[model samples]
Target: MDCDVLIVGGGVAGLSLAWRLSPSRSVVLVEAEGSLAYHTSSRSARQMQPSYGPAAIQELTRRSIAMVEGISERLPAPIMVPRAMLTLGTETEVAALVAANANLESLTHSETMERSPDLRPETFEASALDGTAMEVDVPALLEFYRRQAIGTGAMVLTGAPVTAVEVVASEPAGGTDAEGAGAEDLPTRFHVTAGRHSITAGTVVDAAGAWADVVAAQFGARPRGLQPHRRSVAIVSTEHPVDPSGPMVEPADESFYYRPDGTHLLISPCESVPAEPGDAQVVDEDIAELIHRIGEVTTVGITGVERSWTGLRTQPADGLPVVGFDADVPNLFWLAGQGGYGIQTSAALATLAAGLLTGTLPDDDGWLAGALSPQRAGLG
Candidate 1:
C-alpha cells in the first residue's frame, strides 16, 4: 500500500492526526491492539482543565476544548459537560496558588465546605475553584475522529504492530544522484512492514504513546528519553449518596484527586512511578494508600473498592509533547510524549502536527512549533 503519511498508533493522537491529514493526504493508521484506544486513551480521568499541566499544555488544551465545543452539535452526544475543579490545600498553599494563576478563585474553609460537604473541615485551611473544568466524553470523541478519518478514505488497520522499517532515499532535485547529493538534500520514503501488511509512505509518524521511543529507535532515529509513568485509579463505594454534580477535588500539591461517579467515588493517588511500556496493572498497596488518604481528607466513608485500573503517561524530560520531524532521520515525524494531557490536547496538537507535516503552519504559531519540536532543547 502506498500512502502520503503512515501513523503507527490507534490512540487519540494518531486517530486525530489521521482525521486531519486524511482529507488532504493519503493516510494509513496501524494499531498493535485489536481495537482502538486500548491503552492510556481508554483509561483517562476524562476531564479537561485549562489550569492543568505546563503553560504550553494549557494553551493546547484551551484550544482543544474550544474546538470540541464548536463541534458538539454535530456529534451524536455532547462531548464536554460542566465539571468544576476544586483544589484544596493549607492557607499558605492556597495563597501561592492564587498568586500563580489569576483564574483560580480563592475560597475560605467555610466556603470550600459549602461547595463540597463531603470534605472534612479540619483537613484543609483553604481552597481554590476553577469553574471552567469539564468532563470529557472520551468514547464519543475517539469514535468521532475514527469515523471522520475512515469517511475521508483513511485506511485503519488493527492488530498490526510495525515490525520493520527500511528507508529509501529519493533522488535529490535537479537530477542529483544519491552519491553526489548531501544527506539533507535527499528526500526519503519508508517501506514499513506491520504484521501482515506492507506499506510505503513518504512520511512516518511515531505516535506509539508509551512505546514512542521504541518506535523511533526502529527508524534509526535517536530516542527522546521518553519515560512512561504509571498512574492508577480506583472506584470505591461511598457510604453516603454522592452528589453527581459535585466538583472534582484535589490537593494543591496534586497528591490525590477524586470525583463523584454515580453512587461511587473515583479516586487516584496521582502517582507517577517509572514503568516499562506494557499493560499496567493496579497495585493493591497504592489503592489502599489512596483510600486511607481520602478517608483522612473527606467524610465520605469508602466501604469497598468496586474496581481499579492503571495507565501509562509517557513524557519527555521537559514534560512536553515531541512533534515535528526528527533532526537526524529524514521524513520521520514524532507525535508522542503527551503525558497525562493527551486526550485533552489531542485536537490542537493534531491540528498543529498536521500543519507542520503539510508545511502550512501559520507564521504566528512559530513559538508553538519551536516548543513542541523533536529537536527542541531540554528534550534530551
Candidate 2:
C-alpha cells in the first residue's frame, strides 16, 4: 500500500489530520489497535475548560473551539456541548481567582459567575465560573473524523502497528523530479511495515500519542523529552442527590477536580507520574487520594466507586506537544506529546501539522519554533 501521507495512531490527533489531509491528498492512516481511541482519547475527562491552563495552551484551545464545535456542515453530530467550569480556592487563593477572572474577561466575553450558592464559600476563599468551557463527546469526535477521512478518499487501516521504518537513504527507485528540489533532488520515501502490510508514503506523520517516542526511535530519531505519565479517573455512584447540571468544579489550587456526569460524578485526582504508554489500571493509592479529595471538595454522600481506569498523558520536558516536521529525518512529520489537552487541541494542531506537511504553513504562528519544532526540544 502507498499514499501521499501515512498517519500513525488513530487518536484525535491522527484522525483529525487524516480528515484534513485526505481531502486534498491520497492519505492512509494506520492504528495498532482494532478500534480507534481505545486509550487516552477515550479515557479523557472530556471537559473543555477554556481558561484552565497556560497562555499558549489557552491560545491553542481557543483556536480549536471553532473546529470542535464542528464547522457548519462539517460533522454529522455535535462534538461540543457547552458546560460551565468553576475554580474554587481557599482565602489564600482568592487573589489567584481574581487574576483568572481578569484573564478570561480579556480573552472572551463568556458568562462569569463569581459565587454559587450551591457551593460552600467558607472553605473557598475565591470562586469563578468559566462560561466558555464545554464538554466534548470524544467518541463521537473520533467517529466524526473517521467518517470525514473515509468519505473523502482516505483509507484507514486498523490493527496495523508500524514495526519498522525504511527511510530511503538514496534516491528512491522511482525518484521523481519533484518541484523546488533545488540542487538537492533526493527522492524522500518512508517504507513502514505494519501488521501484514508494507506501506510506503511520500510523508510519514507520527501521531502515535503516548508511543510517539517509540515510533520516532524506529526512524533512527532519538526522543528529546517525550514523557508519558499516568492519570487516573473514577466514576462514583453517590447516594446523595446533587445537581446533575451543576458546574464542573476544579480545585483553586489545581488539585483534584470533579464534574457532574449524569447521575454520577466523574472525578480525577490530577495525579501524574512518569510512565510508558498503555491501558493503565487505577492504583489503590490513587483511588484513596481521589476519595480524600472528593470528601474535601463536596458534601455529597460518600458512595462506592462505579468504575475506574487510568490513561497516559504524554508531555515533553517543557510540557507541550510536538507538531511540525523533523529537522533531520526526511519525509517524517511529528504530532505528538499533547499531554491532557490533545482532544481540545487537536483541530488546531492538526491544521498546523497538515500545513507543515503540505509546505503551506503560515509564516508567523510563533508555533514553528516553540512547541512544534522537534529541534527546539533537542529531539532532533
Best prediction by lDDT: 1
- Model 1 weakest lDDT span, ten residues long: 176-185
Candidate 2 stretches greater than 4 Å from native = 72-77, 100-118, 169-185, 366-370, 377-380
lDDT of 2 by residue, 1-380 (tens): 87889999988899999988987899989999998887788888987666856666777788888777655246666767777777765544645565765433211112222333344444555556678888887887778888989999999888999998887644544554555443245656788898887998888888998899889888877785788899988888776766677778777667788877887888888889888688777787888878876776567765888888899999887777787778778777888988988988777778887877887778877654365677773542
lDDT of 1 at 250: 97
| Tens-digit per-residue lDDT, 1-380, candidate 1 | 99999999999999999989999999999999999999999999998988888888889989999999976878767878988899999899988987887558899989999899998888889999989888888999998899999999999999999999899876556675647766456678899999899999999999999999999999999999999999999889988889988999999889899999777899998999999999999989999999988999889999999999999999998999999999898889999999999988999999999999999999988899899999988775
User: Residue-pair clashes per candidate, as listed?
Assistant: 0, 0
TM-score of 2: 0.89
Against the true structure, what is each candidate's TM-score?
Answer: 0.96, 0.89
Query: For all the candidates, what are their Cα RMSDs to the real structure?
Result: 2.2, 3.9
Over the full model, what C-alpha lDDT does candidate 1 score relative to the true structure? 0.92
Task: In candidate 1, list every pair of residues with a backbone clash.
Answer: none
Q: How close to the true structure is residue 359 of candidate 2, measured as C-alpha lDDT?
A: 73
